[model samples]
Target: MGSFTLDDVLAVRKRRDSWWTVFLVDPIACRLALLVANHTSITPNGLTRLSMVFGLTSAVCFAQELLIAGAVLFFVSFTVDCMDGKIARLKGTGTPFGLWLDYVGDRLRVLCCAFGIASALYARTGDVIYIVAGAGVVVLDLFRYINGPQLKRVRDTTRAVARENSGAECVFMDELLGASAPGSSTEEVRREFERAGDEDGRELVDLQRGFRAQFPWYDRVRMFLVAHRVRSHLISGIEFHAAVFVVGPLLGAVAWLWTSAVSGALLLAFESVLVYRAWLATREVARAVPVNEREKVLV
Candidate 1:
């Protein structure tokens, strides 16, 4: 529709991404996005639909026990998945519907892949463990997605209320990290929100206070990771999916069990840390703020 370059696509790329994406997907997605932006009249939703086609096809390949082909197809589907967001951001074509579609599409792709992989494995080995592992993959993915956003909503509402009632000074680290990625400096984040001046400026800081107070070393570790442009979420959904769907397939059948196990453990471990830090922060906030809706629900 218009002239664009690789730089334009890169500029709209996320400030921080899952490390799997940073190392593997973006190098390809960005270039493809550049081509799509400049050449085709294809919309972001169109790309998303195309991605679903590729994704479902990959799932079929897995069901047929074409593990290598399935992995390659899945990777292509994922790379295309990455491009839709960039295209949306660059073209200002983002829609609420698009967000909903992208999210639903991802979840469905995971479910299908899990089923295909599980069925294939079970068919070959007749072992119930493969069936269970596939089901575990689906359940864990659901658990992560379901819990994460709801927890953030609760955290956001709590912090927003606490700030309003306590009349406490706004601090960037606690509130801002929930919205942005976790690696930004305090001053940089403050300046960013102040520049943007949206209501989204500060709502995640409750945990920051308790974290900074209770575990002073955590910030040092986070900062060290930031130096390498890596966010400290060591094992996120992206890594989980890649391990289960891509790396395991490439390595061979037996590898899936161990790879997914290791990745799942890492994911659960990080999730536990987030929960504990939130607990410390919420406990501190309860003492300071007037009773809010969250407290009302508990009572």
Candidate 2:
């Protein structure tokens, strides 16, 4: 219940040890780029702006149905996306304002790109379905931003208030460590318990630790899943543009059939899953107990 800062949030996120590196294959390379950027006096916001330009360019290319160019640009844009945060962290210049701007910028880019693609695709094939699908993607992304952390904050604040009023403070470590899963080792759980710093809570910590450590390769798999999923969608989005624009004359009928069937189905499925996960993540975040003591305690 203390006043939280960006540093606190970032530290915790860092501790989670993202498995994205396994899928990215060049996570450290991005980090090194950030280091170079820092030495050259580059700011995180600058990198963020650069990423925006690249993302916008990619979207423009997709709208024009320039398949190869769009594909290359999209990846380049994402790579730039990876660098912005690293530069911020490496230079120790992460700011609340900057973070907010970056978050909003990403959403804006998504919305704009969707509009652009829809417009271009429509112009080519005169199909309303392409526009609808593009709009749906934007809506899904918007929902993710709105219902994700915002909703989670509401849930957590409510829980914290309820527990505190009842003379009980919920500790996240207690819940995380105590969680049990099948096929976990004992020693691994013990270490996690020790880290929690409460003898009474050690048992659960040990168990949770065991489960996490046991799946050493799980992070890699998870990252692979994320990259594969993202790349697949990117391809689908591009293909829709292709069929609607580039091949609209020769493949108009076939393209409409495929776009309305394949891309629509996949996009819906992915969006549904993403929305559910976003909701769950928000709820979990709302439950996280503040650990630092320097800030004023809300409870």
Candidate 3:
């Protein structure tokens, strides 16, 4: 076997990776991925497709009440999900189509897992609550997918406008939320804000600061959830399955049901706040920028 190290794995990780991935999942997954990469001729897309198989298999196991089997398969699927990107980076063979396929696979995995769990619980108890919980998960996932990009665009546009007006490079929102890159100096970021003298520039900075103030706790929680492409959606899936596979077996099925339901409701509420805040911040930035600039921002 080819020798690999922790630093080698860390090299492929993104700047704003999720805390769950950074602290728990990646260490093991990355090691496994490196070993597989060194030993085999598999492509990154091959690993991605393999993950989809494990994900669907896990769904089936969950639907059949094979809790331990389902949990094991889910872990395997997630591990491979992490591996595909690492392999892509290692091989330098990543393509846009590969990214698209990975995204589609993720959506499918979530759908299958949620539906399988709901159907399984419904079969056992004949209640509609599980179905509702499952539906809620799907809806929230859709919202997160749709809203996340829009919010990012708004934030990016705001920063661009500020930069144009102030002639200073501003820090990204993720940095303020504590996902700073290595060697990113606080003084440099502070100077960027200090340079914002024009009305549009000042407004942009204020809106960014206000967003941070409004969601201090969310920012903290988001640090751990940040690694996923769709953080909220991924977190929801993790919470649901953790309840089913871990809590269910330990606390009994009844506890799992209630926990999943309550957690889904809470997630929906949290997502609502995020969307609302993003909208408000977008509006503030849009209003501050010139009409032509705003049009460009939207485009």
The lDDT per prediction is 0.78, 0.49, 0.66
Report residue 191 deviation for candidate 3 (angstroms). Answer: 3.3
Tens-place lDDT per residue, model 1, 56-174, is 99999999999999999999999999999999999998888999999999999999998998899899999999889889888889888886897686566556666776665334374
Ranked by lDDT from best down, the candidates are 1, 3, 2
Query: Which model is ahead, 2 or 3, in terms of lDDT?
Result: 3
Each candidate's number of clashing pairs is 4, 5, 2
Ranking by TM-score: 1, 3, 2
Q: How many Å off is the CA of 254 in candidate 1?
A: 0.7
List where candidate 2 sits over 4 angstroms from the true fold: 1-22, 25-35, 166-299
Q: What is the alpha-carbon lDDT of model 1 when measured against the actual structure?
A: 0.78
What would the per-residue lDDT of candidate 3 be over residues 1-299, giving only the tens digit for each residue?
44656577668776555445666678788888878877887888898999999999988987886766777787788878889898788668688999998989978887887788778888999999879877776776676677668767766776677557545444445555344433444444455545553534543244444566676665545554443322433444455445544455345456657766666666667667666666555555543565666555433
Stretches of candidate 3 above 4 Å error?
1-5, 160-173, 176-188, 192-206, 213-252, 283-299
Query: With candidate 3 superimposed using the best TM-score fit, by how many Å does residue 115's alpha carbon deviate from the native?
Result: 1.7
**Alpha-carbon TM-score of each model against the true structure:** 0.86, 0.58, 0.76
Deviation in angstroms for 224 in model 3?
Answer: 11
| Pairwise lDDT winner, candidates 1 and 2 | 1
Model 2's alpha-carbon lDDT is 0.49
Best by lDDT: 1
